[model samples]
Target: MKLRSKIYLYSSVLFAVLLVIMNLAIYYIFSTLSVDNQLDRADAEAAKIAADMRRAGSEVSAPELLRAYVPIEGMLRLYAGDGSGPAPVTSAAEGELSTLKPVFYNEKHSEIIRVDGRSYAFISIPVIWVDGSVMNVQMTQSLESTMDTLGVLRLVLAGTTVFALLPLLLSSRVLSGLIMRPIVQMTATMREIKQSGKFRRLTLDETSKDELVEMGQTFNEMIALLESNYVKQEKFVSDASHELRTPLTVIESYASLLKRRGLAHPELFTESVEAIHSEAIRMKELTEQLLLLAKHHEHWNLSMKVIDLEELVRDSAKVFRNAYGREVTVKVKGEVKGYSDEAKLRQLLFIFLDNARKYSDDDIYVSLEASGQERLITVVDRGIGIPRDELPKIFDRFYRVDESRGRKQGGAGLGLSLAAEIAAAIGARLSMDSVEGAGTSVSITIAAGSGE
Candidate 1:
């Protein structure tokens, strides 16, 4: 069943049970009081009759005494010895009198007896005469009026219960709806989103600080993250396909040419073989970079170690100078230390220096500076600097400001992206300052290591 229905059902059942119990208690108390009031009236009349008999002594007249002292609304009887006595003061029958015989013999004091299908309260008292003879006085009051009063009271209570139930049911339904409204809306919104495959958020009530509101906020945030990741994955796939297509097309074209005429012509054969080999190497490098990017996208476990930032920079510059015969210079302020993965830091430096060398024939400057709690390492190149708008996208995979230059220099446009990932993994910040023509400087700031 729905939550609203269940709530209404349970609440109604509870209210009904409470109503029954309360009404039953009230009925029982009222009935006891009414019965006691009747018995008290009967007892009072019997006492007056006894007092009158004691005052009259042996000459007391049972008929006259009963007539004078008995209540007008009830019956009174006198039994001088074996119940062979004057007729009762009221219109009660002999059968009704016989029912009271047990009260007289058993000393029951008082009891309620049913006569002619109507209820009556009976009271008995024994009196002793001056001659030592005993007499019994019996009085009875009809319960018809009391029963009628209680009947009316029960009707009133039942009516009140019914009246109370109308509002109770309505209020229960309304309150349950109010409580479940948020959950219903959430379910509906989710169903619509599932059908349309769209990212939608719940309309929250900011004024309410309820748990439902918090849940809605969390759900919206989760969907937003999912949407962002979904868009990024789509873009990544498109870019990877585009980047892979170029080298594959080159390789295919050269292979086709070699298949057609390179075997017959030895000169064309040498050129085609070299072209094919070069394109295959480019394809292999691109695949490797793609794999590395994927690995970094997953959980990257960094083997953190304390490494000299100054020493790492000098080593990278030396390798660049020796390998490419390019002019590279290093400047260090002091023995700057950093806590990070040494191998990843070296790879990051290589990415920056390689980009610098690819675009510039001038000398590249590598420098490390120590400041307070951070070590700043910079690779500066006086190359064709990136445009202001393109600088923001330099770390994006397969994005290059100088695409033709990048492809020509065997750069797959993943170097800066990889460098950014490594820097992030090592708790460093990678930033760039570039002008259109002056120069570009890539900087990495890492936490400074202790002297220990």
Candidate 2:
């Protein structure tokens, strides 16, 4: 789940729990107050009924007197003096009092009762007679209305709980998303930098004065420092390689002259001269490849314009044919026009053909086609295919699939790296799919409308 959703979920749950607790507490407090009020009212009514019973005369039947009593006159039930059974009662009858409390000065005056899930307060008052005797006058009051009110309150509380939490849930989601958006953008920018070795410019709104913006700024600074160091290092390597090439070429020429002068035996002279020449040629190729890579990396800029990729491939194929006749076969298919550097595209295409001639037999397939948003240019060679493990590293600088074999084949192993740099400069992607025994296929996919 996203961060926003998780925050909203957790906050909603917490608020719901708190709302329930608050509602329950309010219900308990209100219920207690209602019960207390009912008790006080019931006690006063009991005392009044007791006085009325005395005035009605002690000689009358207790049930009759209770009937005549006003306060306890209704909803009052009287029991026999001996506590044996209930006597005749009416709507005026009050429920039984479990204890003898009204006549005893030290006894409790009132008690609580429950009936049908409703609470009530019951009180007993002493009815004093002329003969120093007493009668119990009991009073009762129903808590039905209070219970109903409480039920309504419970519903209200539940509704209030949900209503209060809804905004918090929504706010949590919105706030979490707002907080993480900058971080997500920064993450995407860093990924682009890592993939292409290019720095991105990021702009954060002023209201977003959070830690994520600070982090983005820090990351931009780091990329700037890395780019500066990388440029300096590439320049140094290119300069050193170029400077060494001239002297090495002169040494090879002088060695060849020594052998031609017949100063040594024929076999020894030929072998020594050939070794010097081979080393010199290898050094020269290495220097050239390094210089090309340095040039592509130095500025991280490509002069792009609209170019016909099919025509560009055709021209490169003709150049290769003129240089090495009939050794490689080049085929073009479908119209592929995109924005790219014409010089760099030509160089990239030549690398494919060169690889084909170096490692494969006579048959090489070059095909260009457009699909969806991408234009794919593929170069397939029926040569000694790359191993599965080495294919991934083929585009790394100076990485050779067959290191020992590549040196003998007069390759410095920088062709694919240079091609990859060209592809990145044009916002194209390069991919190679190959199997151990199967011929390798290198595909370059440029945006349909991207180039020159």
What is the per-residue lDDT of model 2 for residues 1-452, given as tens digits with 9 covering 90 to 100? Answer: 96767767777787778778888999899888987887887787777766766665557766677566534323554432444323534452334433322223323368777755556676766555545554455565666677788888888887887787778777777877877776677778878878987878667664766787787677677777877879867855674565466557666676866757647556557666676776777677767777667674547556787788888777777788788774445566566787777887778888888888888766677788878877788888876788888877888766677767875786766778788888878777889988776688988887676542
Can you give the lDDT of residue 340 in candidate 1? 87
lDDT of 1 by residue, 212-276 (tens): 78888888898799889988889889988888898889888988988898778878878878888
Per-candidate count of clashing residue pairs (backbone under 3 Å):
0, 20
Against the true structure, what is each candidate's TM-score?
0.66, 0.45
lDDT of each: 0.80, 0.70
**Which pairs clash (backbone N, Cα, C closer than 3 Å) in model 1?**
none
Q: Give candidate 1's error at residue 318 in angstroms.
A: 2.3
lDDT score at residue 296, model 1, on the 0-100 scale: 52
